[model samples]
Target: MSAELEGYEQDYAVLTAEITGRIGKVPRLVGDEKKLMILNVEKQLDEARELLEQMDLEVREIPVQSRSMYSNRMRSYKQEMSKLDTDFKRSRIAYSDEVRNELLGDDGNSSESQRAHLLDNTERLERSSRRLQAGYQVAVETEQIGQGILENLSQDREKIQRARERLRETDTNLGKSSRVLTGMLRRIIQNRVLVVILGIFIVFTIIMAIYFSIRRH
Candidate 1:
């Protein structure tokens, strides 16, 4: 691999690692802090995408005999980037749900006043009940969405594992091919040396025969 491509791969690894670490911190954060972290992660993701594009270009310039390995690496990087993006989205949704729950909780003022007002008015109580029902429906939908995200994450993990296994297999095959080629090369060099030695021997024998014939004549 060329030096340029190797540098890009290193940069991509670092950037992705940073993004992953930041994403992990998001759930621990709240309010503006979480928002800022998410924005930063998004920007880093864009950079990561650009790096992948650069890597793809570099891989294309490589010779076909060696390009498959680099191409596979690129695919793995892309899959990782996709997984990171999905995790970021999930984090945002979780943060939103957390904030929503906080707001929906019974605080001292608003919730208490509503309860007192409901006691005095039947119509208001009915309205409050309907709102609660709608909130319950939203909660159910959110739970379903969260479940789907979990399933997708599991699938992505499997794909990454398969990709890793394929890469290892490719490396093993390349190693075997290298050893075979080296052995073939060694044999070819030895054959050439033997051929040169035989040629010289044949020439010397002819020279001796000619000299002997001249001396005898």
Candidate 2:
């Protein structure tokens, strides 16, 4: 399970890093918020897995099928889009120094250019966002399936543990019974020896009394 989970996490990190790679800035999708979300999903998956193991459930990695996997991928793409959106907006807002002074820091001549650029970038960002959202939804659905299986596995593990404990107890009791039987055998042997000695003493005393009585007569 650990191996499976680690594989999932490794792929997730790689996907996020690749998508969010940028110039003069850290990876976006790998940022704290997204990272936390990914981590949380991972934790959930692990818990479910542990429960499954306890139940002796057979688990296997489905390979990029979990929500965290898709989310990690989408997260990277979204981060790249975010950077593009930020750049587009900032560029459209920036104006020539003279233009800035002439119209209260607004460029009327460049207004059309700004609007066109911003609009184009906005559409691209929106499209990317939609794609990411869709991918994220799929990832979430996969995680739900994982959770269900883990839940079922947990029950099986508990049953197995209880059975194992019972078997251990039975074994212990049998060991004690065997010891008791051995002690009884030893005591029986000791008593037989004592009875034989007592019998010999009684016989010797009776023979001496008869011999002494005959001689006196």
Candidate 3:
């Protein structure tokens, strides 16, 4: 890894950690303090984005073999950043809802009509909260499904690589067997030819012996 890439990574990590800490504090605070913390986190998130872009440029310049590992790390960092942003947004919304509820509470001095109006607003907030909860649940399920699909695809790629290696091994073994069969066939043909030559020599000798005996007689 280049020194520049390492520097960017370190900066990103620190920025994200700070952002996470600030987001955690947001819910515990209220009014101006909470709003200011939210703003600070948002600013840090933007800085994190810049750092990620710098890291991406560095990764592209690196060698191909090492690029993949860094690229994967970059993706992981982006995902973490996204989750942090989501958590921060959720905290901000929860804080807003908390403030709204406090405002809606009927002080004992509230008239009957005022109390009734507050009750109606409270009901609307509750309905909205329920809808938001339902949507968040669906989003979570969809993310899980997408993760599962990616895992399956990764497994399938490994299976294909293993199958290709096995095929290469099989081809190598077949090549050896073919050479062995060829050698055995050649040897069998040579042996047959030797046997035919020996038979012909024996027949010639027998005919020569018969002709010599008849001439002697």
Pick by lDDT: which candidate is best?
1
lDDT of 3 by residue, 170-203 (tens): 9999999999999999999999999999999999
TM-score per candidate, in order? 0.46, 0.32, 0.47
Query: What TM-score does model 1 achieve against the real structure?
Result: 0.46
Q: Please provide, for model 2 over 1-217, each residue's C-alpha lDDT reduced to its tens digit, 9 standing for 90 to 100.
A: 3465456445545543443332113222333854464454445434433433332211223433444454444345445444544543343345445545565544366566765787787777767767776786577557767776887799799999999999999999999999999999999999999999999999999999999999999
The per-residue C-alpha lDDT of model 3 at residue 130 equals 57
Candidate 3 TM-score, true structure as reference: 0.47
lDDT of 1 at 25: 85
lDDT (tens digit, per residue) of candidate 1 on 12-58: 98999999999988876787988899899989999998998788778
Better of 1 and 2 by lDDT: 1
* Candidate 3 least-lDDT 10 residues: 92-101
* Model 2 poorest ten-residue lDDT run: 19-28
> Could you give the candidate ranking by TM-score, starting with the highest?
3, 1, 2
Tell me, what's the RMSD of every candidate?
22.1, 14.6, 9.5
